[model samples]
Target: METTIALYSHDSVGLGHARRNRALAYALAEHLPDRLGGSVRGLLIAGHPDAGRDPLPDGWDWLILPGLTRGPGGTVPRRLGGDAEDLRALRAATARAALTALRPDLLIVDRHPFGIDGEFLPALRDLRAQGCAIVLGLREVLDAPEPAALEWERLGGAEHVADHLDAVWVYGDAQVYDPRLTGELPGALAHLATTTGYLGHGRPPAPRGERRPAGDGGPRAPYLLTVLGGGSDGAELARVAAAAEPPAGHHHLLVTGPQMAEEDIAEVRSIARPGTSVVRSAADVPELIAEASAVVSMAGYNTLAELLVTSTPALVVPRTRRRQEQPRRARALAALGAVTTQGIDTLTPAVVTDWWRQAVATRCDRTGIDLGGLAVVPRLAAELLGHGASTGRATTGHAASGRRAAGRRTASRQEVRAVAV
Candidate 1:
């Protein structure tokens, strides 16, 4: 029988969660038809009403909810412009109605389980009673575990997720950092935890005849490309990157993510020098990375993964205040010699410029870093659907154990050398 996966992405504030979930949804649908005897359909339940308006794949559907917003300290903002109780009632009604209508075989809750507003609880319970497989699609990091556990408990999130979720697919490699280090995966759901490695969003191939021209009229010499993952917390980085005067032979391309405010965009534009271009989001980032002499960016997981694939000489300026994930991820990559990292506290214009100069001069061979993350997406889809075995074998032959599979293929030639020597 065909499987229908309803993905609940309660992304009220930033583009990262929603964008990543969309990628998984697309992957599931795209890969299912070929692997499974029946097709896969996806329905995305968006907590942000405005989110549904974004373009989605053809087979995907959306159910918009009463909007939620991110408040101080990354907490879900309470309902506004209506009585709190009345708003909760209304949201509950809407959520229940939507769940009844969709009736999916699988429920993939992206990031959070209670749907941002605690309004999806009843619906989640009802779906579970109907035997729908409830899965939690968590990104690798969730700040710190103790604080997350307390907050989740306060919000009744931990209980809800633990009681209902059948699986928790963490989109990261556990060898890097344990998910338990960031959140309290309750004992009830412990057996369900699966490290799917990193489900990196794959980029399209570079277009034909799209080579960057050469010379002063050709591609400008030694230009730095500075980007913020979603631009929500990138004002300071944008300013620092924009204000830095490039060396005589260099230029800059500053891409502000779509989430950046207009005022911030204008501020970046005002700071742009003669050799700099300040653009609001572009579809050709991978192309830019491929052609650029170097790149400077926030260490968002997707960005870091892309850089690893391109092996582009780059520096990671991690975001620290919003969450600790970026810093940890950046530091990990730096440890691997995959990229240089500018600590969040030391990222002044002068410091950025210095790093840029040093980075441009550095000739680190990034060929040692693995770029095979994207190839794992199809494999993940097959594994999730129980249709194919992962190429790697479990170290202990038990799924519940926290060990990685042995005999996994290595992407870099260095891994081969390590194995050989």
Candidate 2:
């Protein structure tokens, strides 16, 4: 028997959802044979224009949907270059068509259970009737509980999760931030919630020994890596960082991201000193982070995951305007001694200059934390498919040999790198 796994990432603005789902897709493609005693295939259906930038496994494929975005008050089409309603219809049709063709054994929906404007409901019903196991994937924190509850209720979110989803996986630890506390998990679907720790970006390229600062001759020019996930709301951070004085010998590279406007780039470049460099993106973000003395960025899921694995010191100025997810996650990480958080209001050039002057190592205390989520998710998926045990970590008892074999296969494949696309 062969099993098919389909992942839906309704990414509108940023690349977080698409990137996280892609990681899971690769992991599952490698581990499915061990758990199901059969061949496996992975399919990613996404609306992100840059989804094609990620590397796929041998058995993995993807479908790019019409890009759709949500505005302040309502839903709007993005990058469709055509009528909004027609594009939305096209996106819905494409998703349903993929569901029909793949007939997946398991389907994972990222972030939104019903998807924006209930675009996924028809497919959910069809998949459920076909006996497919559906799962909802969540980040550590969504907005604050009260507002989150209201939004969920208004969106009919609880009904969708309870009726359609077989399980929910949180890509974070419970002690750090619990979805239950946020009231996002309805009482009926509470049992489906499982915290799978933080998804790691494998090992960083820099050797662990080389991660330490230069020991000789006072403070050498530390390399400062500045990134803001999508770069839409990151102009201020980039501008201030470009103008701010670096630590004694610190040179700087500012990756404003692909979504940054031309004006924003020019603005950051206008004040950038001779040694400062501004790039739209990096080939591999984790590698770039590994080479940095420290990072200044927003508190997005992928960025946080990379920081955790690389054990890089980070100064996060979370975006907390319409959404509190960033700030909440940042504060939670700060509580665990993982990273430092600052307010955008206070992110003045002087403030950043003062902080970098003293900021040494702010790496979080990772003892006993779950950075193995890249491995744990496959185990959970196996359990949901009813062919394996439901252990929190990857099975290591009788399945240890299988895991080792999977590791070899993973190593032989292209090196796993986080793409900001």
Top model number, TM-score: 2
lDDT of 2 by residue, 367-386 (tens): 65567777888887776666
User: Each candidate's TM vs. the true structure?
Assistant: 0.80, 0.86
Clashing residue pair totals per candidate (backbone < 3 A) = 2, 4
Cα shift from native, residue 56, model 1 (Å): 3.1
> Candidate 1 regions off by >4 Å?
48-54, 72-92, 155-160, 181-188, 201-222, 361-421
State which candidate has the highest lDDT: 2
Error of 1 at 23 (Å): 1.2
